[model samples]
Target: MTKVDILAFGVHPDDVELGCSGTIIASVQQGKKVAIVDLTQGELGTRGTVETRYKEAADAARIMGVDWRENLKMEDGFFQINEANIRKVITAIRKYQPEIILCNALEDRHPDHGRSSQLVEEAAFMSGLRKIETSLDGVAQDAWRPKYVFHYIQDRYLKPDFVFDISAHMQQKIAAVQAYTTQFYTTQTADDEPQTYISTPDFLETVKARALMLGKRIGVRYAEGYLTKKMVGVTDFNSFVQETT
Candidate 1:
């Protein structure tokens, strides 16, 4: 079985890259094994087809240096929080047995983002329940739950419980997002396709601006914000001190 230190989930292919790729890059640089699980192929997206998005997601995963990437093949706009879907997510959680799980924002501009967040959160909890049996490839699996569950900020600005300093990985993060040529503004993309909200140049600029704003809060050049259901504890005050220039 493949084990990872962190498992990140997103409702769409580019969601993880747009929201938390910087953090993922930084974590991998720190020798932590990370994986990505996209809930859908983004078939309902206005721009790219499912095949294009899958290819883009694979390229983004490569840029982020993730151990693996998987798609649940769920309905893009209408997947429900039912028993079947919950079991699917639970099986993945048990399979990877990650130390931490990062998921979509609890509240976001996209309805799927919020719904998927809740679904992942609930499944993470249920994954630890021994009575709720789950198996992988006909082999019985053991119950496993991550030590921490964090929601990455996306689209809407919510007060973050904590922020990760990803200053060094910001450029790589942008590169990962840019991997989705059909989704974001890029010089290579032709004008034939109808432009959407995210296809505009200003959208990318706004992403940078948000990162700058969050970085300012944590005294860093760039950072990614996250929300946690439970209050996180620190081992010491020294870790919180800002570095001297």
Candidate 2:
């Protein structure tokens, strides 16, 4: 079975790149195995087809140097935090048994993002209950929960529980997000297609600015912030490197 140190889940194909690519890349650079699971193919997105988004997601994964990537094929706008989807997430939680699981913001502009966050949160907990059975390839799997689940901030500003210093990895994060050529600003994205809020160049810059502001708060050049369901305690201060802006 393939094992990973971190597993990130996105409500849509490019959410992971937009939200936490910096942190993901940083973890991989530190030799931690990382993977991404896109819950939807983003077929409903204004700019790209599902096939195109799939290719883009793969390219982003390559840019980030992740070990594996998977798409759950869930309905983009219609999926619920019900049992079926929860069980699907549980299957993956047991499959790789990652040390950390990163998911979309618990509250965001996109309703799906918030719902997915709760779905993943509950499923992670359910995965640890031996009574809640989940199987992989017809074989019963043992219950396993990750050490931590971090929700990456996106769209709307929510107070972060902690922020990761991603100054060195910022450019790489931008590069990974740019891999989704079909989704963001491009000279070729027909003027007649009716540009949405995210298809413009200015919005992309805002994404960068958001990261910069969050980084500035913690005295870093760039960083990605996350919120946890419960308080996180670090046994040693060695785990953090304070940066003074």
Candidate 3:
């Protein structure tokens, strides 16, 4: 079985890049094997064609040093969080069997983002149930679910249950996002497409500011916040540093 240390799921190609690339890069740098599974080809994006998004996703994956990145080719804007989609995600979850799963924000600006998170969350829960059968390549797959599921903060700032210090990995995160040249801020244009909310130059700066703001809450230089459905358990306080001046 092909297993990864962390598996991130995004509704669109750049959602992962914008939301949690810093933490992803940090985890990989710490010797964890990470992978990304994009639920859509982002065909509905304003700035880039599906082909361009695919190439850009590949570039971002390379920059993130992810072990693998896969696309499910789901309908970009209309995909539903139904059994079929749940099973599709389940197959990838079992294939990777990651210890941690980084999923889209529970709720976000794009309806698809929240929907994708619900689909993945339901799939993860069902995957742990042995009775829910799934198959791939004509073979029956074993039930597998990630130990932890973290929903990254996105367009809307939902209060995070916790945050990870990512000061050192911030630059790498920006580079990964910039890898999608067809999407974000750039003077050079391949076509005469109009700019969207994400294509603005300030978008990147806003991302940095958001991280900094989150970090400040915990007295850190940078951090990515996440929400948890359940309270996280910690065996000892020593595992977390106490900030004191």
Candidate 4:
């Protein structure tokens, strides 16, 4: 079993890139082991095929330096919060045994984000119960629970409970986002491809702007934001020392 320091969950292939690639990049740079779990192949996306999503996700994962990444193959845009789906998420949680779990926002412009957020949150709790059994490869699995589950602030601009400083990794984060050439704006995309909300140059600017705004709050050049149901406590006040952006 490969234990990780953090397991990041996204409902679609590029959700993690758009949402928290900076945080992941920073964490990996700091030597924290991380893995990404995408809930779906993004089969419903208009611009790219499932095969393209897999390749782009792999490229983004490489850019972020994750230990590994996998998709659970949940139905994109339509996965329900049922026992089957929850169990699927729970199995991944238990398999990785991460100390921290990052997931989609509680609410977002895309409805799937909220739904997947709730599903992962619930599964995180259920995964700790000894009676709720799950196994991998034919062997029985032990019950495991993360110390905390944090939701990354995506699409909708909700106030973050805490913002992570990712000043050093902003450009790398953009590179990770740029890996999804078909989904986001890039000259490499074919002319016949239809333009979607994310495929615009302005959309990329908003991604940069959002990080800038969040970074400004924490006195950093760029950052990523997260919301959590649990209260985050700090041991030392010195940790809050402001740094110039």
Candidate 4: which stretches are off by over 4 Å? none
Model 2 lDDT per residue over 56-104, tens place? 8999999999979999999999998888999999998898889899999
lDDT of 2 at 73: 92
Q: What ranges in model 3 sit over 4 Å off?
A: 187-191, 242-245
TM-scores for all candidates: the values are: 0.98, 0.96, 0.96, 0.98
Model 3: which ten-residue window has the lowest total lDDT? 186-195
lDDT of 3 at 9: 95
Candidates' lDDT values, in order? 0.93, 0.90, 0.89, 0.93
Residue-level lDDT of model 1, residues 1-245, one tens digit each, is: 67999999999999999999999999999999999999988999999799899899989999999979999999999999999999999999998999999999998899999999999999999999999999999999898988999999999999999999889999999999999999999897658889999999999999999999999887788889999997798899988839434
lDDT of 3 by residue, 97-147 (tens): 998899999998889989998999898888888998888898899999788
For model 1 the TM-score comes to 0.98
Clashes of each: 0, 0, 0, 0
Candidate 3 TM-score over all chains jointly: 0.96
* Candidate 3 local distance difference test against the native: 0.89
RMSD of 3: 1.3
Q: Indicate the residue-level lDDT of 103 in model 4.
A: 95
